[model samples]
Target: MIPDHNNRDAAATPPDALRVVPVEPSLHRALLRLRVRPAQRDRVGSMADLLADVTQCPGSEPMAIMRGDAPIGYYRIDASARSVAGRDFAQPARGLRSLFVDADWQGRGLGARAVALLLEDLAVRHPATRLLVLTVDCDNRAATRIYQRAGFVDGGARYHGGRCGPQQLLLRALP
Candidate 1:
């Protein structure tokens, strides 16, 4: 079992065994056990709610970030721009949504690792996708930094459609 720690050290690196994979039946129970901290509830919402959103929305692909056979985080890639950015994208883009690390796994840099892998995975999975779009809440500076580090560029535009408040629409071109 992974040890629980409350301190979040951004510089920490993720384990080498980490892999981002689609959420399948065998991993469903483990993914359901993952949760973000209480303070992050509004930003990412509860796992149950996110799962429900994936189910109700067509073209939404739910993925799990795993270490061996255990899930450490979760996210979704939505083909519909409206479902992710709440607006039409200028080009062929996939929306990255509902990304979050489990509360027990927060400080380990797994989020960044998952993103790097996800981007690589996207190129192969979506050969025609020219861009990847996502909206980060304005107040979520940490998340913004992580995305920025992963090469997501911000255009200084605010998306006011988020449940918490205004969000920055960040974009990155996919290979």
Candidate 2:
């Protein structure tokens, strides 16, 4: 399990209280059941579709954001630099895709915590990844704020590659 060291009381909390782990065969079914709010359906898309995508895209890792033994969210790390930044990034980077907490588990600070855990996990899993890039829907202020608070910076340019319309391009340098 990945630890949530960003928390002030991280030492007080169990190391595995929240984390991101690869979607193993045993957790596939439960991970597929995770869903976002109705309004967010278009932003993140379905887990089945995203899972299938990871299989087709080489170096893409499908992961689950877990709280104890249950999956509360899901996301993918794409090692292909062109898959996300196009010509924006010129160095080794990873793309953060399909990140969302289950609707039932939202509004409890889990999303932010999950992102923090993901950054920590990436440092160990992909030591070569220096930059983390992602596109957040421009209208999704809540998610934008969360990403910003977690240290993702807006590049001030909109990425029009998303099916849900234009998205704000955000980047973060991984430690």
Clash counts per candidate, in order, are: 0, 0
Instruction: Give the number of the best model, judged by TM-score.
Output: 2
Residue 20 in candidate 1, Cα distance off native in Å: 0.8
lDDT of 2 by residue, 1-175 (tens): 3433334454565644887778887888898898888888888888888888888999898888887668899989988756876754767788888899999999999999989989988888898888999889888899999999999998777988777888988999876
Q: Which tens-of-lDDT digit does each residue in 1-175 have in candidate 1?
A: 3321211332253554676777776777788899889888989887778788888988999988877658889999999767666677777988999898899988888888888988887877788998888999999998988999999999567888788899998998877
Deviation from truth (RMSD, Å), model 2: 3.6
Off by over 4 Å in 2: 1-16
- The stretch of ten residues in a row with the least summed lDDT in candidate 1 is 2-11
TM per model? 0.87, 0.88
Worst 10 residues of 2 by lDDT: 1-10
